[model samples]
Every structure is written in structure tokens, then in C-alpha cells.
Target: MKRRRGSGLSETQLGYLMVMPALLLVILITIWPVMLSFHNSLFDYRLNDPTRSEKITSSNILMESYADNHYYLEGAIDNAASSTENEEAAAEVEQFAEQYNSYHEELMSFDGVEETFTTVEEMLAGFENINDNELEYVEVDNEFAEEYKAFLEDSAESLGTYVEEGNEDGLENLQSYVNSSANSILESNFVGFENYIDYFQDSRMWASMSNTMIFTVASVFFELVIGLMVALLINRSFKGRGLVRASVLIPWAIPTAVSAMMWSYLYDGQSGIIAHYFEQLGFISDTSQLLSTGGGAMFSIIFADVWKTTPYMALLLLAGLQTIPSDMYEAAQVDGANRWQQFLKVTLPLLKSAILVALLFRTLDAFRVFDLIYVLTGGGPANSTESISVYAYKVLFAQQNFGEGSTLSVIVFLTIALLSVLFIKLIGSDLFDSRTPRK
Candidate 1:
């Protein structure tokens, strides 16, 4: 009988159709955000500073603040000129006002700016807020922005000297007006690859990366060893095996942040049982050293992480262990193979895929360690235990420096991507080797 062909789409097309939703979801969540971050990383974006608060590609005038400031600014400077007693200072202030008026006229003369300025003035007079971006910001030439910003800054500085010597009354207010107007003109903050360059040169970045590597390696290594031992113990038939497995998973089941906080108390210098025991056992010279010293803090976090995550690793391995048949051990025993020989010849070979999977998962997880370290040490004791993730969080949120923060985030993504590729290569090869039967 011929194959039924009700649908026109081929099998490959149908396969893609089935997976399209998942592919779209991944792009939406993962790819879209990374691309946005990359675009932001090119600029000097920050929320705290009004001048660089937005991602500007070219010079632009903040019409709302500028229009209001300019309305008062012109009158303020003219009033200062008339109110001053000193002829020299008065002449200088008048000259400054004339120069400023010329710059203002030049700025307004720019194509479309005059119309935008008129519209902005009308909105301000009627007390209507300029909420539309197109109406609120007018793009201008780079040269004019640079000149205008420089003139306002210099004028403010010169006016400050006059105010100090009592050369003019209201001179301070005039200076303030000049400064406010200057702030309304934002220059392009776009700086492609410069943030990356600076961060690569930064000592703190390298230090955090180094700490991340150390933590990943040490914690993963210990977890593998300890987890395998636990998996083997639990895999064997014994009374209360179910209870033992559940109890072992208690640490992994606890939320990372909560467990980290709990460990912080245990590692506390004063009135901590673990700290006291460690000190008495000659692990450290004093109880305070556990979280106080750089080496001690790194060691403390690594130890805590191994204790918390080993159970999870054990669970993964135990699943792999259960898949192996008892007949393999029986066959090995009939061949006069010792326990160690059976483990080496049969158990290890069969568990290769499981070990590779567990390693890859734990390695990636350990590399991105953040919350536990954050809650426990706060990346302090001189930032000796600070990972790249913690450093990125501080820059992104605490400092409100989005540009540099995004750059750090991109670095993290790239590193994680590279690590994933490496692991996948090893895993793919091992699985392929296993599937191909020996001759």
C-alpha cells in the first residue's frame, strides 16, 4: 500500500513545526535580552546621572527642562547684570549674557529646533507636560552640543568667582541657571568596546574571575567524590534505605539563600559552634578567621557548597546506578573478578554517561554561584571570594551603572557559552563511543 499523504508538509517540516514554539520561547527569553544588553553595553548608560541617563547616539536637547531653565536663565543673567555694583563685573556679566544669548539664538536657528523650541515654550506656558519623546527631545549637531556644554560650564565657573568676591547679587542664581541648562543638553554616551577594554584591564574583574574559577573547580571536584560515595552507599540494598535517601537530600532541598544564611551563623566568629570546633581542631588560628580572612572565607564557602550540593549530585548518580543490571555483577563474580575489579571493569564503564552528565551540570552550576556566596560573605573580606556574577550584580543594581554592568553580563554569557560547548563536546563523544558496540 502507498504511504498516506493527507498533509502536504513533509516529516522534517512537521518536526520543525512541532518544535517551533519552544524555539520561539528560547529566542524571546534568552536571545532577545542578550542582544538588548549588548546594545546597552556600547553606551555609557546610567540612571543616576541625568546627562547620561538615556542611551544617546547623537547630541539631543532635553526640551522640557531646557525650555523651563532657559525662560528663567535669560532673565536671571540680565537681572544680575543690572543689579551688580562693580562696572568691570557688570560689563563682564553683560558680555556673558550677550554671549549666551548668541549661543541660544544659534541653537534655536538649527533646522527644526526653532519649531520644537516654540512648541516646548507654548506647552510650558499652558502648564502641559511634554510627555511625547518626539516633542520632548530635539536632535542637534555634535559640534553645537560640545560648544554649548563648554560655554555653560565655563560661564558658571566665571560667574562663581564674581559671586565669591560679592561682585554681583543674584550671580549665584544666574550660575545655577547656566548649570541647569547645561545639564539639559546631553552628548552622545555611545562608546563601542571601550567598556569591555576597561573591564579587561580592571584588576577587580580579573580577581573576581579568578575566584569564580577556584570555586567552580574545588566545589565540583569534592562534590563528585563525595556524591559518588553517597550514591554507591544508597544504591545497595539495606534497611531504612528510603529514610537515608530522604535525609541525605535535606540539604539540597533547602533553598540556597536560606541555607547560605544558616551557614553564615554557623561560620560566625563569635558564639558559632562550627567556628569554635574548627578553631579547637587547629583548622584556623582563631574562630574569627573563618569568615574574616580571605583564604578562610573561600574555603568556608567551598565547604558549605560541597555540603549543600553533594546530595543533588548523589541523586543524579543514584538514578544512573539503578539502571545497571545485577546480572553484570553476577557475571563478573563468576569470572572470579574481585569487588574492586567488578567496579572498575563494569560499574565505572556503564556509569560513564551518568558521570559526564553530573559533572557538566555541577560544573556549570558552581561557575555561576551567586546567592550562597552573596548571603554568606557578601563578596567581602576584601572581595576575596567575589565571583563575576556578584560583581556584575553590584555594578548592574547597586551602582546603577547599566553600561558597564551589561558589559560584565555579556562577559559572563560568553564564558558560560564556552564552558557549555566544551562540556557538550566531551559528553557527545562519550555517548557516541558508548553507542558504537566494541568489535
Candidate 2:
């Protein structure tokens, strides 16, 4: 006997099973990045900072710092012993110096630590930066690490006391050396929510966010209007219509960075062909004003974006228009409906799903605008065109401020999520709701 397919699973159940792989893939690509950024944002992680180069949750020793400080510290302690004139003071200084050396050697005696320490020392002497974590950092027993770190702190206090008793040139330097050594045992760097709190006070972050919203709203609105018109015009039969459709996609075909660069030269104030025409047409005071002023630069960017993406919007709308049955238009016309009435009554209602989908894509894409603006303007003429994505890029990669930059990245993700939710709830509800069977 042949076995029944899908066993007892209904169509809905099979549908869910069919889509599981896609859902898993989406989560991996989308949610994983946000979670990673959130993890980094929790700590004071920065590539520029040796102590905070990674997301850490426990106390650890930076062997590199320890080695460097100990080298200077050993000299400072000897200098202290030699500089003291009084016999009693010199004996006390010598005793402390011996204690410090003993502790330093004991720390090195930890399993495998001595070898790592030697390698680090040799590398340091060569002025090499220890990029390998195994060579630079070590996790030790908390109790042992704390005690050793405390001993270093106490050494610093003792040196300060020596300084107070007599103005010794070497005592101050020794105290600083002990303090630096103490810092080699780094405390846990898990600073929760501090990064999120910091963004509230970040003025430039807010400016970039505002710029993103403006860019999204303006670019999408115009793309919709212009794209709708192009789709309607192209939907009708005409000579060389296929050729026109192919040619219309050329602007969108260009890579975003290349298009932005192409437009940059075209928007040049004094010599740009586009800028010259706009100036000659009396649209501006001068050709140079296209990229020199805040408003003009923003306008220039928006104009370029519209030129590059209008074809995309048209393509999406055209697909939707084709799905529309011509019979409905004929019926509307038979009922004495004019061209305008037929569009308003039959066309728009049927095209709502397409409109919603197109808006969703374009809005998110425009909100995350970076390469276009980055190449064309580099967020300048004083950063007037900087989007949150571009700002995040500068912070994370340019400044190497990973902690603060991760927070910025999380903000962008959250903002995009909010926009997606809004679109789904307000515009896409009808489109998606129809999938459910009626009671």
C-alpha cells in the first residue's frame, strides 16, 4: 500500500514546515547581527584600547601591561634604594624592592605563564604589538589575581609615604610605576546599559537620525509618485516599449557608489553639466551652490537618489500593474467611469498590496542610505547629509570606538524594526490579514 503524503498534517502545517528553513535563515542573517551588536554594546569594547579590545565579563591580567610596567618598575625600585641617603630609609626601600620582585616572579611561575611572559618580554623588546590574545591576556584565579593586584596597590601607597617623608626624585616615578602595574589586572568590563544611556546625550547621533528620517520620507514619497507615473506610461503598448523599459533601468543598474560618484562630478558647482543646466535654467544662484550649502547639498543628494532609484520603484509597480486584470477596467469604462474614475475605483484598491510592499522596501533601503551619500558627499558640507548608517560606519570603523559604535548600530536596527512594524501594522495588515480563513 502507498503511504499517505504529509501524514495527518494540514496545508497550514505543511506550509509552516515548508517555510521553516527560510525563517531560520532570516533569523540567522537578521537577528544574529543585532544580538552581536547588543553584546558588544554592553561592554566598553574598543579596538584602540588594549584593556577593552574584547567583550569581557571577568577579571583578567594583561600580561603585556604587566611586562612593560614591571620592566620600568624594577628600575624605579633600584633607583629608590640608591637615592636614599639615611641608612634606615635605604634598608626599608631595599626590603620593599625585594618583596615586589618576589611577588612578580611568583606571578610568572603560574603554569605556562612564565613561557608566555618570556615570549611577551622578547616581543616587547623588539617593539612588537602583541595582537594575539594568548600572549597578551591571561585569566587567573580571582583570589590570587586580587591579592597580587592589591599588593601592587599597597606598594604604590608605600612609595607615596616615602615621598611624603622626603622629597625624593625617584619615589614619585616608582609610585606611578606601581599604579600602572596594579592596572594590569583588569576588572570586569561589563558595563550594562551605560552605552544605551550615553546615546541620549549624543547630539551628533541625534542629528544623523534626523537626517535619516528626512531622507527616507522625501526620497520614498517622490519615488512612489514618479514610479507610479512611469509604470502607468510603460504599461501601455507603444513602439520600442521593451527597449524603453530596458533603457529606463540603466540608472538603477549602476552600483550605488559608482552612481553617487558619477553624480558628484555632475553636481560640481562650477563645471558640472547637471549643475550648469540647473543654474542656466535659473534654478540656482550659482553652479557651486549645488554642493557648497547645506540645503543645496541635501537637495542634490535627494535628487541623485531619486534619479538612481526611480526605475526600481517603477519596476515593482509595473509588476503589480500587470497582475491587475484588464477586464475590471473594461467593466468600469462600460459603467460610464472615466479614466480617472476607473483608476481611483478599480486600480488603486487592487494595487494596495504592491504599493505596500514597494513602500516597505524603498523606505528601509532609503533609511539605511550610506554608500550613496558617503561617496557623493561623505556626510558633508559639514555633515548635513549624514545618515545614521554612515555615522555608525565612521564610529565603528573610522574611530575604532566599538562600544559607542555598537550602541549606534543597535539604534539603527531598532529604528528599522520600528519602521517595519509601523508599515506592517498600518499599511500591510490588510494585505497579510487576508491570508487567514474567515470564521
Candidate 3:
């Protein structure tokens, strides 16, 4: 007999209803912000603006803003000015006179003089007497024309010399002029990309990147090696093994920031226990300071990370170790395999999947490392500990350059995504498959 149809929701509809909450959450938390960031990346964004609106939205405006702020405006301005010929020079003179008259009117307004001076018009009519007969000239109220002329002459001479030598000094100077002019046009608006560019081009970026990589690789590698050894030792039945296992997990269970702070105190040269011990052991000449240098600061951070993380690695591997059957080791021993051979042939091969999972999690965590470095060195000693995240934070919030800061963030995100994909392809995907089946 055919069954009667129930309330009639299809499987697809039920599935959609089940996932509705998660889908809504993904849009709210991830998709919306990503779309907003991409939209903001297209414009010139300044963080200091409470509104977060782009004053300049077009690519032309964005490029112009960047060029103006970073002194990259010479090529365009020079090209435009050079395209004019002798025929346009007379027209340009009249235009310049009109602009000067407008400026003079504004200046007079500032002084409470509402009426335009007829004498000023008469003086302007005698433009022939003006040096070079160029309308670019303007009469100053209380300024030395000779000094201005000398200044222009010196600037021109320097620019010529720079061009002859193929130096970019002239270009930089021209770009500065453009920047000042553009800023004036924009009513002295704060364009924050200047500081962002400075931070990006600074040596601090490279120093931080290098320090982070070294700390991450060294700490993770050593943690894996040492954690494995500890796991193996603790896996065996022994007196006080439960206490030893709990003690090892204590470091891992402690908050990372708190542990870093504790280590910082220990590394303190004046009153730190570790520093005093090192001095007594003759490892250093004195305990005046331990983290003053770049090397010392990096070592301190790495040591703290390894100390806190190794127990976690050991625990993860130990879970896998417990899953291995005792018969494998017995058979290896029966086949006359030594301890080293048994480890290489039986333990390591059996632990491949667990090791890969541990490494994957640790490596990804290491890549975006910021807090430990922040607490330990505060990206100090000339920013030797400045990770990309910290640098991006300073640019976005401190220097208030949202556009460039977003650019750096996008770069870091891409780097992490690529690394994660590579890790999965290399090891994560095949981790379980690599394990040998038990007989």
C-alpha cells in the first residue's frame, strides 16, 4: 500500500531551513565585511575621518591622491605643462593676470577693503615693465622680490643639475609642489596615506617579517621534536607518570599572554631569575639587560612560545600514541628490531596522521603571530619585532591610513590562504591515507 504524504516539506527545503542560521551568520560576519573592504580598497580612505566616507572615489582621484601625498606627481604635471607652445604663452599670460587679480581681491577682502583699487589695475596695465613680461609675476604687499627671485633661480639651477645627473630629486621636488597645491585645493584635508607609505617602505617591515619567520619556524620545529620525545617517555608506564603528564600540560594550559608577561619578567636583566642564573653560569658578562638587542629579544620571544606550546604538541601526539596496538611493538621486538628501529619502523609511521594535524594547526597559528611579540618586545628596539599585523594596525589606527593598511591586510590574508592551501595539499589531505593498516 502507498504511504500517505506527510506535511510535505521536501528534503532540500528541510536542509535549507537547517542551515539558515549558519548562512545568515556567515553573511553578517564574513561576507559583508569582505565586500565592504573591497569597496573601500577602490577609493582613497583616510582613517581619521569619523564618517569613513571616501572624499575621492574615482580611480583618477585615488591615483592622484596617492601621487600627491607620496611625491609622485612630477611626470603628469611636467607633461601637461610641456605640451603647451609659444602660441599659448600669450593666452597663458592673460589667464595668469586674471588669476592674480582674483587672488588680490581675496587678499584685500581679508584686510576689510571692499573696494577694488583703480591704482592696482593701472599698475597691472603696465605689464611691460615686469621682468620677463610674464603674468606669473605678482606684486607683493610686504615681501622682498629679490629674495623670491633668488630662491626661484636657485631652485631652477638645482633642478637642472638634477636632471643632467639623471637624479630623481627634481621629480620629488615637483611632486612636493603638486602635493602642496592639491592639498590647498582640497581645503587642507588630511590624507593619511603619507604615513602609511612611510611605514610600508621602512626597514621595520623586513625586520619584523624576518623575526616572525625565524621565531615561528624555530619554535614549532623544536616544539615538535621535544614534544615527541616527552610524549614517548610519558607514554611508558612509570612512577609519578600521572603527575608528570599533568605538570607538562600546565604550561600549555596557561594563558599565552600571561605566560609571555611572566617570561618577560624572568628575562629582565636587573632582577630576573633566568638572567641571574645565566650570569652565574658565565653565559653572559652581566645581567644588566637581556632583551636590549635584536637577537636577545627574538630569543626571548621564541623561548616563551616554545615553552608554552610544546606540551600541547606532546599531548596531541600522545593521544595518537595511545591508539597504537601493543602487538606492533612486540612484533618489532620479536623481529630483533632495536628501540631506534622500532621507533622508525613502528611508532613514527603509525603517528604520521597525528603529527601532520598537529603541525598544520601550529604552523598556521605561528604565521599570524602578534600578541607574543607585542607583549615581549612591543615591536621595540627600532621595531625589530613588528609583525605585519602590528604594522598594519599602526597604519590603520595610529597613522590613520585605512587604504594602505587595508592593502597590507589583503596581502597578509592572501599569504595565509596560500600557505594553508599548500599545507593541505602537501600533507593534510593524505594524512590518514598514509597510515599503514594493521594486520
lDDT to native, each model: 0.92, 0.88, 0.64
Q: Please, what are the lDDT tens digits per residue for candidate 1 over residues 1-439? A: 3343469776777888999999999999999999999998999999888899999999999988899999998789778877888787787788888888899999989899889988989999999978899888899999999999999999899888888997455788898988999999999999999999999999999999999999999999999999999999999999999999999999999999999999999999998889999989998999999899999999999999999999999999999999999999999999999999998999998998899889989988998999999999999899999999999999999999999999999999999999989888856466555566669
- Displacement of residue 49 (Cα, Å) in model 1 is 1.4
List runs of model 1 lying over 4 Å from the truth: 1-4, 83-92, 165-168, 426-428, 432-435
Instruction: Report the lDDT tens digits of candidate 2 across residue range 1-439.
Output: 4333658776777778999999999999999988999989999888987667777787788999888988898888789778877676677678778887787777777888889888999999999989998888887767777788888888788768767888878778888988898889876778899988988788888898998888889999999999999999999999999999999999999999999999999998767999999998999999999899888988989999999999999999999999999999999999999999988999888988899999999999999899999999999889888999999999999989888899999999988999999989987888777576679
Higher-TM-score candidate among 2 and 3?
Answer: 2
- Give the lDDT ranking, best first: 1, 2, 3
TM-score of each: 0.94, 0.80, 0.64
TM-score of 2: 0.80
Pairs that collide in candidate 2 are: 269-287, 269-288
Tens digits of per-residue lDDT for model 3, 1-439: 3333364776667778899999999999977876665455444568675324444421111212222332333353344245434334324333433543454344345332222233333344563232321222222332322332233344334334434444444334553453343332221223444544654586766666676677778988999999999999999999999999999999989987889899989989888998899889987666754688766677777888899999999999999999999999999999999999999999998899889988988987887887887787887767766777777777767878677667666656666778789988977887646688689
Which number leads on lDDT? Answer: 1
